[model samples]
Target: MRGRLIGQTVAVMAVGLLAAAIDGCSRRVTPEDFAEGEGATAPAEMSPQQERSSAQPTGAPEKAVTATDPGGNRNHQPGDKEPLEGVTESTPSAIQGGDSSPEPTTRVSRAQRTGGVAERPQGRPVQGEEQAGAVAPQVDQSQGLGDQAVEATPTVAPADAIPIDQPEERPQLAEGAAAADGTDDGRPAGASTAEPFNPLRAGRAGMGPLRSEGAGGEGHPAFRPASTEASHEGGRQSKKYDPIAENGPIFVGWPKPQLALVLTGCQNGYLEPCGCAGLDRMKGGLGRRHTFMSELRNKRSWPVVALDVGGLIKGFGRQAEMKFHTTVSAMQLMQYETIALGANDLRLPAAELLAVAAPVDGKTLFVSGNVALFKFEYGMTARYEVIRAGGRKVGVTAVLGKSFQQKINNPELEIIAPEEALAELVPVLKPQCDLLVLLAHASRDESIALGKAFPEFDVVVTAGGPAEPPLDLAHIDGTSALLVEVGQKGMYAVVLGFYQDEAVRYQRVPLDSRFPYSPDVKLLMVNYQDQLRQVGFEGLGVRPVPHSRREELGAYVGSQKCQSCHEVSYRVWRKSGHARAWRTLVHLDPPRTHDPECVSCHVVGWNPEYYYPYETGFWSEEKTPELVDVGCESCHGPGEAHVKAEMGSDLALQRKLQQAVTLTLEDAKKQQCITCHDGENSPDFKFETYWPKIEHREWEDE
Candidate 1:
């Protein structure tokens, strides 16, 4: 099939070239054609001295003009003057050389032949040449033969004449085709045919070459014309997804309410997006979230009550613990009234969990019904809380589901059934406030079950759902209670409005580029990085483990060692963005050089999948400067043994080492590239497109 396609493509190209050549031969020309335009009249006879005086220095090499067809008859008639010493017929084809045959057929000019403009001389024109609309000298018909008129070419070529070459000029079609202006020739309606057709000249001034959908050249994917739907789909995919626009504004048709409830959670350790892809493509950062909240409280002047359904950090480690603290601090700055714990939050040690949940200025920081730290109720967390907003008492409580309960392995933690906990708190909490809210950190079904079981609650904010939550509210099967999932990754927020007589209004707000970075949260990020730097790798619990195949394969030797034998591959890597990954981190707003989560991907020796360092992996810039930035061993196995075996006289060992280090394109697509270009960071990553940017296929072996 491929061979047939190649053959068809070549045949099509050949046909196009033939068509273009035939089009160039259609326009005929003769010596009398020069005097055919308007206002052309033959000049009166002049003496030899007057003719010499009227001639201008064109500076071009003088050549003896001759008839285009050498075999054509040149019989002298009665009134005909003899041909001038060095001049011949003034035909368009004669100015530019034509065919040597006797046939009267039109010949393509030298400019068209070379696909470029002919070199014309440059000098000042003789006086009287400046007159506008001055016509070319004409031949006298009364002479019975013809009057040979000597015409001087102008210094400045006219607009309708041959154009100067442009680097980005679009290709022009041959004469007789529908021109750039939709005429027979590419000119105005009443324009003269004085300028001979030059197919090499641009179809129009400032026009660039045509661009096709997949016209990218070498090192890019083969051309594949996209359908209209495919083109629209590609445009949509290229930009950040906007759920808000797709699902309309929540409060657009509703009147301003007395109270607005802002719900957010399931951050999964993302205080902000990685932003490595591009800020325009990034969404759901704490910086943008704060800005969104600030607009509600300050800009729109609405009374707001912010709450969270937490899954605060994704992983359990010293880094996560610190990140939890930073996230909590940022949320507190945003004035969140209450926060509920999710499964990941329960993975922390009992002491650390208590510390993070600790009250600020005698106010509760975290509220949960089923989870208990140290197997007992603590002041740090509450079973339920009633807060005042817009002169109404609003009750809030949280419960961890049985499914999430199974994931926690903390010995000091006590987990109870969500039904048992909620059954105990609902009756007491319902009457205490005008509106009861439940923060259910569970799956969608479990959340719905809780909402159905306790319809007394006005709203149930759930944890599990799509990355960008649906704008339309999900109601309990048989109650007025609304079930809401605020999505994951802190990318969006659900705002619920409370009115005296109107229906409760809901809005899903995506924390997109429209929101500016909040200075308060930005400073917290800076301080968070500072904390990471002070803690160092060990303090953050980063202990490098030995490579899984260390004994069989090898230990990592920096990319510099590979340069000795693979200079071409080394140069390719040096020019790729991977080589400057570490520098990119250094140039980040807060400089995440010290942040383990970011540094793990940017530097070598670190495990990109687990976000940690290997036994011989990069530790610090000063300690392992050679390992800075992603390098050869990032994809290939460690190179120490391979380098040694190749340098030594052990042929069998060298073969074994080389085989271990060799990475197939299939393996890279499935395992290697994805380690760093995962969905959260490089969302637009495609192996086909990305591979070409860093491809180094200089190896001899297949």
Candidate 2:
């Protein structure tokens, strides 16, 4: 019975196979039948490549692709060519499964795959069908027939069905999601993985490394522009005749006057010019200012009434405190009668301010009408002071504006509004003096309003205005009060000369090189430098901070180490002015080696922008002799990593080090050079002219 059953099963199987073979032979198989999503299998005799080619969806055209060679040249394959507009070329790793080995592969653009039509739903109609209002066919996705679902969808290819050859062409994935290639690394799709470009890097093609702008990295101490009239060559004084000498006498046509009111303020802690570029280029300094005042009193033999509408220092710290004291002492030596405190001045500790304002030789020098310490008026400051000038009583009062009052955060300080303070005081003080002056540490508009509101003030010396004040005095509309603005950084002074019969002449004087440096002020500067040296950098409130690129670039190794491999470039730098920067400071009448402001620009390891030292920056000649002067590291960044890389046998590391130090000429012009050659220091600095002087390279033929 078992043998009969087996024979019957074998006969049934043979008949079924024979019947299927006959049915298949009745019809011929076509490429359309093997189209993707149709569920039709390829013929047994077809090769894998041919099978893939036939697997393409029906109606999709074959596209020609460009293959990249090892030399980066491209070769085109034979097919219908499609324009590759808007397609970014992918790396070999992106297309070839983490294998960067040079191998030719077809490159297909997103546009080519979609037949010049933007991707849409798989079965959705094109623009032509949409215009005709053709309805989309529905797909039964629940049936789990992938081919049927694909066939029912419209124009857009299924997102997951991107061809293996075009991985980069895949649609953008959600941010932080893995890409089709599985190397997204959490970055947004298509984001670059290379390091950001730094223009300041050294040895860069087309541009050389950075060069220090001034002797000491600090540049000019004052915030004034260089004089256009004067020009210097080869570090010498201008051969051209001095403009101030040829321009005839100052205050050109003003008649002889009884009293000269010399106005100066907004010193901003510039005791003297750095004089790095040349004295002729610099405009204002305390030394030059004193000479101007001295000439008014002794040379012209005119009675002088010196005053300052204050903004004494720029920054706050121990350095600022010292600068404040030095400025006040210098003002006293110039015989300034009154100094009005500005917002910047009020930032100082209240106790320190009171001490500075205290009377010297039984005479108060600082005055403010609205400010109070601990909510009560104290110290040497008074609401108003009457002074005898030009044989007439002059009433002077100062008020801090309401706008500036908001900037102060000290709980111990109390500030009354400028208008309110002036209102109460003006009524009482106006009758006592023949000339009334208001020192308004306020905005220009507020000053004008005060002048217009009270009309009793004869002159208003305002703090805010253009850096260069107008030649003529401004009068408040509908009021006789004159508005006087002495420009910022103490670059210019507005002198009001009062003569018999109330005749007042206005002269705006630029404290240029025409005025000689005052010996008295020079002594003060020497003393100030001495004080800074004793206090040291740390004592002056400056501490070393880590370099921004410390880990990658490493610590500075000076220019000498760089000299071994770069002899030609080193020789060029040796002869350049930067190498002799330290000598310039030492040769000055009063040596500035001890001065942090001067030393920062002249030496290595200091950040020129902040005027502070880096972790391994120059401190003193004895401690950091090798790091002295503006060395190679100033521009190229620290060289420890670069040096190690170059000395090693690794060719790849050497190439990377070379690239790391490279700087571009455009970057040097826009970023690196400006740090030192700013308006105040290198006023006559034009990159086109200056660059040629220090231009150097390893290969002269290039």
Candidate 3:
């Protein structure tokens, strides 16, 4: 579950990773490598030896630490597990050496080693190291695999619970949580040593016991309220989940972006009902686009732009949606200079969308070559414009695909073969613009055809069509043109980077809604939540909850204080990354830092804290546990009944295991890691520096 986010650094080992003092030290045990992963820890926090370990060529930022726990030694499986059995470190194992910027290459999956046996059916080396028909082992076994692997189970829940001693930033619940008996019992707020805390009831109602309501007097769980407190605790030493601090927009020294395009609006039969793609809600807002775009822009000087290739929100019977779907809203938030009309966005009886987009302050430009202004016929207009930057002029425009003409509504909108339209236009318009950039909501096949139809064009940024994992750049008539897309609901954006001229080539970068937040955006999010809720989108399956999952647990608690005895886990919970998912986005202190833009994914507290006004940054009024980071409610569901169930002794380990549902094993671990790893969610997440140290006695894999 290695994640990608802006400013996250990877180690090439030694020179590649920058470890200052990790080599030659005795090995220590690290916490179980939960499927989820992290960034290199902060420099200031690294132990001298640990720092040296990072400087290795293996690119692994972390090395096993010297065992401090009374238990055996570090890096050994808890049950001994026979030294990982027959496995040995393989060759070309993603070693970073001194190189940080890795030109993207095909690599193997991490699951191959972590869980799934490597696909290799090993055979003896042909002769010696001499190659005969040796299939060089590919794919690194550390980063996990592709595909959102969700290990689904009947999710039982505990009250929103977190450790108290953790950073004030950790997620937590109320104090005096319930035991098997519903009566409030004392539980350690921050210790992982406490007995299993399970809820009394089952289903969503059973998770109440884990919530931490009464541990601290302030009602806010006890943890990092200020940096001074952390400084007092040996400066950076006491911090459990500390992030490695680094500066970015580092184009010259980082890996080029890997890109993907996913379309979501089409019905199985064609264009009809919308699909959630199984997501709880759709989150494609224009403002969000700006952050993702800015990140990609900062990644490379290569030209990058995202366009709504159409169909997204097309079925929204609402006026704003029909009229170019916040076309104005998108225009306002989407910083791209060019926009093409998706059939759904343009099929409105009236074209008010054009007016809405007409005067959106110059930076956002519009384009369409196949549609006549106010006519049902095809004619070119000043719809899209190109830019001459870095000595290259890339002309941008759009045309509805022929299939859309009168197929649905708005027969007045003319549609033509994309090839026909481009053929008629590119030659005539070729000299008018330097690079031809098409904003088509057409399918991938059509996009490919369009690219081939006109060798005159340079790049195609499309949306609205369904696609597979990710598509790379393709050549059309010997010129370089690439296809770009972002999955529906603003989940991701595909950024293409090209430099100098047509023959120079380009690379694709990926941008998603995971980055630091600004105050202004926070206020807007609050308003949007209310708006969506008012529009009946809250329980609409995937509509996002403005608060984190933890807050929901808090509100679920029936004024019963759950933090009387179980104090340790609750305290440690505060420092967990889960609690701070929302805060990182709005905090933004670590410029180009980690943060989460989506609120629904976080476990919130009982309180909803966020207010993003336009002019100002995230105002204090809008900040809350749900928006700030991991809260007790994240892991737990609402807790009122679970408290009662605990009062009844219904809590059990069996019940607890059934309740924690996540995409993949790695996904679940990643979620847990989100409680602290930096970059997007944990911008400062460092491996060797802050990775929990441990020791274990080897045992047979039972």
Candidate 4:
């Protein structure tokens, strides 16, 4: 009884002491003690390449494809126009996909307008013509990016004269799914896949040989990104630039007080496979661009204007229709900008093009005083609209490609000349917008004629030609106009900075091997790959199947697993991105990210999927995803067959998976990256773009 009483007394005394202390303090808890957090951080941002590097090998068994290489990267002087929109008439498909002029902003007197040329109302549109919201017809370009009116039938065109626009319509995502396996089956498949890799025997997904960080786990404490984002996102950090600001107008005097400018042909027709160059299967899409632009202005940046030059693709492929659908996605990505049509611009019918571009904010501005789509014999061009870019009243006019004058066997089409149009409106358009830019489909030569015809003009971004643009300057009739080219096959991405002074310098730095790749990409690959090992790459033979076949490749399999057998070659191949290629695709943002033209090296089970990164959308259980790493079989022949080679001697093995291969180094590079990337995929694909595709053979490194 005495002990219990004493314990109660002590507790009472302690409580009393605590109460007295609290009374002496400011309060129970001052606001400073629990201040609300002012910021939040998730992790790092990685490039697509870095995103795939650390993936786990899942998917199906890889089959070496000898026929058509999806990564047939090529470069060309802005080639002839691709077909209009959608798939070929012979091929079934979905969506459709089109160029313009300037308005004067100077407050002119009503008396002057009455005395000069006929005064049209301020709101009247010029070249972006169409019956308001009609949809664009889908036109498919079959083989290469030639302007085909149909889907690919495995035929090659003569190298000389090229065909122009044709239209077709198809679903957009279907193309991404199809391109994942390099096929045109219009199947529903996820476009993501892990690169081929041989784990130290499969355990869980993504837990590669090393530990992993999330896609947002790049360990760069030094990087401080712009603190702004889009309506659908969180804060995004900006890329670090060297800070080369020379005077006021940045990026070619963009979106001047009264005028804004936009450049396109980035991925118009399809999503490229890997890089940010050209469009392929509609995979390389707005999912990222939307995210990018959303942040562009959130950082106290100015509103940007937009435009497209042309040749998103060869214009005839299975996913051609889907390419046109990009306008819908683009509208979603940009949200508030107006766009003009291009030459291949009319490949898809005009009514449909308007429908796709309708939803975004801002007034529609179609600036073209020349080139009209046919409506009976009158040349019905009274359809374009006008819009504003910064606070200034800029006008736009879209000119139809000259090919419209050639022959689709349609005589009703009476194309007007751009030269005459410029001559007639120089005085008017010059004063309307503080700055003027043209989205022309004619060759640079034609643009020069138009530029010289109107010295009042500021710039002209052009397409439609056969001569390669120079890496340095855009010379239009000897005038230092800015000319840029993002080639095809998704090879690279470039940011062209323009200054107001005549003494400007622009250099072409290929996104090839020479670039000091961001460590962010590699870090992301390592992290996510380990996290999602269940999903596979190529979607054929997954990790659980066991890649023991490699041990049966004749003398090549001299020992046990990779650590024991083919030690030297295994080590080299293991580190190479080839093995991790498919995984890279698997780890992409999604169905919207897999462009056939872009994922040449990203496909798994080449012969089986018939499409790399093979799918329009990943339909696996809702949120579950997969790793995307380069895997084992990319550079090597498929192990399934190589394992069957036990019946042959070492010589046979050499003949097949020969480390002593017959393919020359140069040949391998071409087969890998040179074809499509050169044309419209990468605007800056130089010899540098080709270098990274070529790896140093181990012996040479020695």
TM-score of each: 0.64, 0.64, 0.38, 0.42
Residue-by-residue lDDT tens digits, candidate 1, 1-702: 999999999999999988877776654443224322101121221211111112223333322111111112222222323321111111111112222222221212222112222221110111121111222233222111011123322111112332223212211221232322232221212222111111112120110111111111211111111112111112244223432222212222222345679999999999987755555445688988888787666534456889898898998889889889999889988888778998989898878877767655555668888877765444446777767766566778899988999998888877789999888877666544567789999976688778878877767888876666542343444444566778788988877765432234455666665566789999999999999999998888888999887887677779999998989889878877778788778777888888888888887788876788888889998999999888898888688888888889998897777788889889999988888888777766688877776777644663
True-structure Cα RMSD, model 1:
32.4
lDDT of 3 by residue, 632-688 (tens): 433344443345444565556324422431123354345544443323333334544
Candidate 2 lDDT, 1-702, residue by residue in tens? 999999999999999999989887865574323221100111121111100001112333322111111112121122212211111111111221223322212221111111122221111111111211222233221211011111111111111332334332222333243422353221222222111111111111110011111011221111101111111111323444242422112342232345567787777877776576666556689887888786655434455777788889977888888889889888888888788888888899877787787555545777777876665334446556767755555678888888878877777677888878777777765555556788988876687788878877867888876665443344454444566777788887778765432124455666766677789988888888888888988798888889887888888888999989998788867766778777767777677777777777788888876678888878888988988877788777888888998788998887777767766678879998788878776665677866765676542343
Candidate 4 — which residues are off by over 4 angstroms? Answer: 1-305, 310-314, 331-338, 349-354, 357-385, 388-392, 401-414, 420-437, 454-458, 464-580, 591-599, 604-702
Q: Write the per-residue lDDT of candidate 4 for residues 103-125, one digit (tens) a residue.
A: 11111111111123334423244
Name every residue pair that clashes in candidate 1. none
Cα deviation of 35, candidate 2, in Å: 80
RMSD versus native structure for model 3: 26.1
> lDDT of all the models against the reference?
0.60, 0.58, 0.32, 0.33
What value does the lDDT take at residue 427 in candidate 2?
70
Q: Model 3: residues >4 Å from true position, as ranges? A: 1-288, 295-308, 312-314, 319-331, 347-352, 359-364, 376-381, 404-407, 464-471, 477-480, 485-489, 501-507, 512-514, 532-702
Q: Where does the lowest 10-residue lDDT sum fall in candidate 4?
A: 98-107
User: Model 1 reaches what TM-score against the true structure?
Assistant: 0.64
Runs off by more than 4 Å, candidate 2 = 1-238, 241-248, 360-362, 698-702
